[model samples]
Target: MTRGGREKDRDDPERKCIATGESQPKAGLIRFCLGPDDQVVPDILGRLPGRGIYVSADRAQIDKAAKKGLFARAARQPVKVPDGLSDLVERLVTQRVIDLISMARKAGDAVMGYEKVKDWLTKGSAATLIQASDGSERGKTKLHPPEGNGGFIGVLTAGELGLAFGRERAIHAALAAGGLRTRVVEEAAKLAGLRGHLPTRAGGHDGGVTAMKDT
Candidate 1:
């Protein structure tokens, strides 16, 4: 299972996490590569050249790898790990997710606003539901995500969603079934793992979801 607790596809390529020493889908691990100066560089997009070293998406795992000489061991050379490596990965992954959502919006595969999202959900066109983590609990409860484990994303703030939709703030959004949806969910799962936990749903009728913030 992925960090998001979703089943992994058997066909997905797997990599060993230097932190956990466990094999998982490449998407569930953050890739790192050795730079010219032997610095450990995060391959968030998995496009950096050279041999890739992997760590689980969790922030603690990344920190463990950095503190335990795991990266150097994997590279078989001395490697410089930057200060706040987990923070760097979080920022990059968060941006990647936001950028993908923006691309989905431009492609007409994503929509924002309660009415539009609700319409898509009602019509069975929405593949995923997105809500701001800090949005009002009552407002968010009016809508539920599609029927699936990764169908809901409440990890992003209203301000973050605003950036994706080109607005000041966005409370609700939905993604249609497409390649973008898959990418968005996959990346969001990584973000969730890094953050430790996510707001899966409301606790009750009025209670809000609580995030397990990273220390």
Candidate 2:
């Protein structure tokens, strides 16, 4: 972790992204390994054995790396990049973020539904606020985010947030201070950067009533 208590920097170990000639922290980059058939497989957890190729988490960076044969150059061997590599990576990262949130919820460090979220916020137990990207703007505006640069995440969709809470859908949620909260913010930040939009905080009802959409 960094001195301020953030997760370790991805570039700290100096991994090179195939797209950009520059090397950076591994946490901000995605790892890939050449499979038996020479296919490039994403190593989301960075635990895959083998010399790994790295790419920045941004969609454009991944696309350029694949299109320009940068993976082969980095790996020093021919590597087969599947079609839609960016989409695949995005899906994997999104799933990972959702899974982390789900774990937090299961551990009693997370709460969904407007009232529960408000209770946490009112009690000063909420460390971060999460709202769906596609949720109604007027509905999201009702809740104020915690006071801090990293206190709000507005990337995941209602359906995605629902996955985290094990519900049909969710528009609002809050995470209590804990290890899982930190992980969620880190992963969600990456997702937000890749997806290219900040979550909306525009609308909601008194008592945390959120209008969830099916987008």
Candidate 3:
């Protein structure tokens, strides 16, 4: 186990990003499949049938791949890339993260609202702190993230977070250990990298830019 009692995968599979030519964990890369029409499709779940093309989850890396014909090269054949593929991938990954968080909430391992989030932070129950990308900075700065890397996610909007927590809107939220917290963290990290900004608090502040989202 790593910090926070999180299990560390000893043999996590790695793939090389076509854009960066760097090998990293499969969880930190986005998978793509060549559709029947020779169109490149984002396989967010990595279940699509085709020769898989891997790319770093960051927007820059995806853009580079499209601009430089990396996908066709990787597929070893000409493939048509859909316009706005990056945005599509971002949306899909965001929805996946939301769904995971919603499941966590249903399992009673997640909570929303400023008071509840604050309580979790005080009790050290929060393994990750989530804030909205469009939230206000002053409001977000009031609460500190857990002391560790990968403990913060700030990419979803307040309304998006609200959906996960079953509320009209949520500016702050916390994820406790267990449930889907590990998946949430992994996916959120990718989303954060792709968006080129961390999720913001209610007062609006870029948490920090990082690497891409996962499947």
Candidate 4:
């Protein structure tokens, strides 16, 4: 399966990574644009207007691109690379996820709390399940992610998920299908890649009482 969930679509827009020289879907790559001062800037939202350079989302690849002067080479001119480009990308992606989830909640397309999430799943209203990575595995296992690809996200910690839900903390959440879910999945894919994980379903049996893990 593609790390973003589901098989690769041939029609998807593709870009080549300057570091790896391999072309991949934009979903798996980060775009860089040259600033007015000719500094290489990581454009997490990919909306910058200029010639765009691409790099795979992996930290090592991004670091290699920066350390080996790949961006300067790609730009074909002197360009300053910001220190800790990969770390900045990671932070941006995480914030993008949080913003997306918050929007979804405001749109009435998402739900949190164990019982509410389980109810949505039982009623077949939730298209994706999100759980905190640092949450208790025992409690997490009590709720199964929706079946099939892109059904689960385990990349965020409890505090991070809490931020999205506007709560002190959250361990379980569910998203209904819509435009927002698509954006969430895409941003989550980038976050997952930077964090070196491809989200997989949480493994556990139903009917077991479990407690949420402390963050």
- C-alpha TM-score for every candidate: 0.91, 0.86, 0.85, 0.91
List where candidate 3 sits over 4 angstroms from the true fold: 1-10, 198-215
Better of 2 and 3 by lDDT: 3
Ranking by lDDT: 1, 4, 3, 2
**Residues 1-215, model 4: lDDT tens digits:** 45344567999888989999998788778899999999888898899999999998788889999999999999899899998889999999899999999999999999899999999999999999999876778688888888766788888877788899888778899999875997788788878888776665652223334327432
TM-score leaderboard ranking: 1, 4, 2, 3
Instruction: Using lDDT as the measure, name the better of candidate 2 and candidate 4.
Output: 4
RMSD of 4: 4.1
Candidate 2, poorest ten consecutive residues by summed lDDT = 202-211
Predicted structure 3: lDDT: 0.79
Q: Pick the candidate with the highest lDDT.
A: 1
Error of 4 at 21 (Å): 1.3
Q: Regarding TM-score, does 3 or 4 come out ahead?
A: 4
Count backbone clashes in candidate 4: 1
User: What is the clash count for each candidate, in the order shown?
Assistant: 0, 14, 18, 1
In candidate 3, how many Å is residue 52 off? 1.4
Worst ten in a row by lDDT for model 3: 206-215
